[model samples]
Target chain A: MNIQNPEIENNVFDVRGLNLWYGNDQALKNINMQIEKNKITAIIGPSGCGKSTFIKTLNRMIENVPIVRTTGEILYHGNDIFDKSMRVEELRTKVGMVFQKPNPFPKSIFENVVYGPKIHGIKDKKLLMEIAEASLKSAALWDEVKDRLNDNAYGLSGGQQQRLCIARCIAVQPDVILMDEPTSALDPIATLKVEELMDSLKQEYTIAIVTHSMQQAARISDKTAFFLMGDLIEYDKTEAIFSNPRDKRTEDYITGRFG
Target chain B: MSAAKLEFLREGREDTMLETDQTHAFERYKVKIDSGRIERRVRLNNGLKHLFSLSTVFALVVLAILLYRIGVQSAGWLDLQFLTSNLSRFADKAGIYGAILGTVYLMLIVVPVTLILGVSTAIYLEEYAAKGRIQRFIKVNISNLASVPSVIFGLLGLAVFGRMLNLGSSILAGGLTMSLLVLPTVVVASQEAIKAVPGFLREASYGMGADKWTTIRKVVLPVALPGILTGSILAMSRAIGETAPLVVLGIPTLILKIPDSVMDDFTALPIQIYYWTLDTVLTPEYANLAAATIVVLLAVLFILNSVAIIIRNKFQKRF
Candidate 1:
């Protein structure tokens, strides 16, 4: 369900003047964007652009890298994420992430799904089972994998593994889910399934996806942000960005003139 | 109709692409593979394979010869008495009972202390230490320690464990010395196993709000366990066969009584074999006893390696 924000109310993430550097190389420049709650936002750009970097910044996952320097204010529910008082583990729980590759733990599908809940002190088997079933259903994979819940996750197809990762993310009951090129590794049919999953997922979790496919942004995202050379060039409704971009660079990129 | 027929006949021979004169000699048929070149390559490959086979056969022949020699000497001597009775001044009554018990006691001390200390050091270096010069320095030294002669570790043990701590030549001192000799191997191996865990797994755990220690315990350790166990067993195997460290620690080669406790004096298999081999001048039967002990020591190493292989195969995963 696309968020029909007649008047956008809550800003799930309010990023302002965000700049990040890797060692001596600058990766992201002054960026400002307001990510709306319960909406699917797609970050699109060419190779070497800061789209992935920007998505990582929202959850502070980028800080996992050494020699990374960031200066900015990212307010999640109006609290500065970079503040020293903020606990990374707590932040990550609220802002769950699905990576580009399907990285399910080398474990049973049931275990993979309940990993988050189990770690969060959910010891009841019945509760964990319920959460796992609900998560798999939400990711649109329950019918296909229900009978084989105890099988190793690696035994699943690549598409199913990616869906399992999505199931894993939602099992944590996260408020915002950040996906970094989640379907770049999947085939077209699998890609379509995940795209459909996103439409439903955004009803619960605020999603910000990074993708190289402009058509995907248009197809799935309600809000689209274009990044180029570490700078955020344009941000608007997906329809407008694809139909009538205001900036010359945005037009050039959308029209396939230059990337 | 006659004019159309003439035009068709003329068109068939035109450059519209199938003229006989346009065809080159090389285009007449497909090229053939040079059999001579292939033959030379095959010959070279076969020659090298033969050499490799010979090298392998040489190693197997040597091993077979040694096993046969040991088996011959062990005839009549490797009986139930040898396994159960203690060392004796006489040949027929001499046994490895004391050495076997001592070895078991040594392992009891070595296994827990080495695993706890080595695995913790590995975890600290891999999970907690910054990826910089300090970590590299400690890592390099640990690896270097593994390569240093076991005798050097024995000297260290003699100076520190045997003298400074004043445990004397007791089983405790000998076990500690051997542990020092093998702890580096365990640490290096555990580090490699821990490092082999996927980075994304840790990220997933952390994203689930698990703390670093919790993540390591739940994710890293489980994934790396087979490797850690294999390494530990292999290191312990090395300790089991060690004679130099025991010698430096001065564990007597003639303890006829079983070591009932860690503080008690002990006689290990290698030390018994060493004394037996040296006392062959007294009676040739000592040589046979030494050979019998070798067979038993070989069995211990074999069991350890077998366990290692079993764990590795059981835990081997596609990822």
Candidate 2:
């Protein structure tokens, strides 16, 4: 479904007629949506509604699955990401992602943060230190972990590790950040910290977060898309969608009639 | 009662009977739990613990006895004079200096060649190769190769490195034969270590802009280093103690001069022990010489394994 907003002049990602299948079972069916630049776009749905699969497709991360196949157009900055001329590494460099779990590398905190920059060939020790500092400050984890940058990342608490992961992604300096339930594994207070981080992060990078919590979508998102069984049921401003949903299923889902 | 109400009462009675039957079944289950079966299970668990301990003790006793026997035989004969002297026709004048040098030189070749070939094959199979019939076939064959008789590998090595390459039973041929013998073990172990690396780590790496080669070198290999090193060193130790492959490769048992290079003729510790044990029928002192050689070989293996354990621990702590 194409629910374009007239005010959104610059779209970061425009997914059109996207159909994805794992072997024979279809996971996403003809999905069409636009993610606006410099905004938090939340995808809300029940489990198994293809929210995670959809976001992974934007950066072609879903191709890691050997049997997964997709037929459609996912345009990033007006270029088709699936085209042969577009390199996956280059696309991923511009579009970074954070997973559901706090998957920090088994390395020192500084090493973890600098991994992305290092992969992109930043070899100067002083330059990498600066990048690590900036990214950690942006992720809001520098204050807690500044003294222990050389300590292993696994030594941190779950919340701190997740922030470290975000800092690692930020070090790459990507234009878009896709979060697959970034706060599902966190407590309410940690979740609040992440929500606040997202609010500030949007000023620097466009974000597409796949979350199971409608309250979170309402609390933090500028635009929200509701997916149901691989279909885009409704797409609109978060306030409008929460207050007066156009689709009956979206209203039913939000009101707890059914998932 | 009315007719409909009478029918409903009849259905309720049947439902009550079914419920009573289920209650009886539940009671039987509870009865079974309270029976002596749990006591029997507890007794079995304790008995099995003791039984496993006994098996461990038995193996330890056997090993201790073997070590004591070898130690007793090597006494006075394992002096520094025996270590520094060259091989001789008389048993009292014989030394393992040449054998020691040969074994060290052989390992210098085997260690590097085995690691390079084994780790590369593992990385190619686990990361780069497509998962299909060919990949499965290669994997199965590699595993099978691990179990193939070491003598077969020696024959293959003799045919390829010895005659075909015109190396002619030099230290290179013997070292190459031992490397072939242990290569499958290293490859299989490396593959398992690489495979055990969590998928999420790779996903996290790719989520950044890291390509496959970068991800493997930085993320996967470091995490798998300990397991890879432990497996490889254990396989190398096995190669050091192995005699059949070297024997098949026709490595000498009594070289007088120390091996200076891979192209020079050499005699390893195992080959010396093998010849000495056989010569004990004519000269009974050769048995003590064999025992002394065993002591030295064991020390070498012990040192190699200890170093590997230290390296494994260092890497394991980082992750």
- Predicted structure with the largest lDDT when compared to the true one: 2
Cα lDDT of model 1 by residue, A73-102, tens digit: 988887999999999889989999999988
TM-score of each: 0.91, 0.94
B123-165, model 1: which lDDT tens digit per residue? Answer: 9999999899989999999999899998888999999988999
Clashing pairs in 1: none
Query: How many residue pairs collide in each prediction?
Result: 0, 0
> Poorest 10 consecutive residues of model 2 chain A by lDDT?
A1-10
Candidate 2 structure quality by residue, lDDT tens digits, B20-73: 588799988886785488889999999999999999999999989989999999
* Candidate 1: residue A62 Cα off by (Å): 1.0
Question: What DockQ values do the models have?
Answer: 0.59, 0.85
In candidate 2 chain B, where is summed lDDT lowest over 10 consecutive residues? B11-20
lDDT of 1 at B233: 98
Residue pairs clashing in model 2 are none
Q: Is the docking of candidate 2 incorrect, acceptable, medium or high quality?
A: high
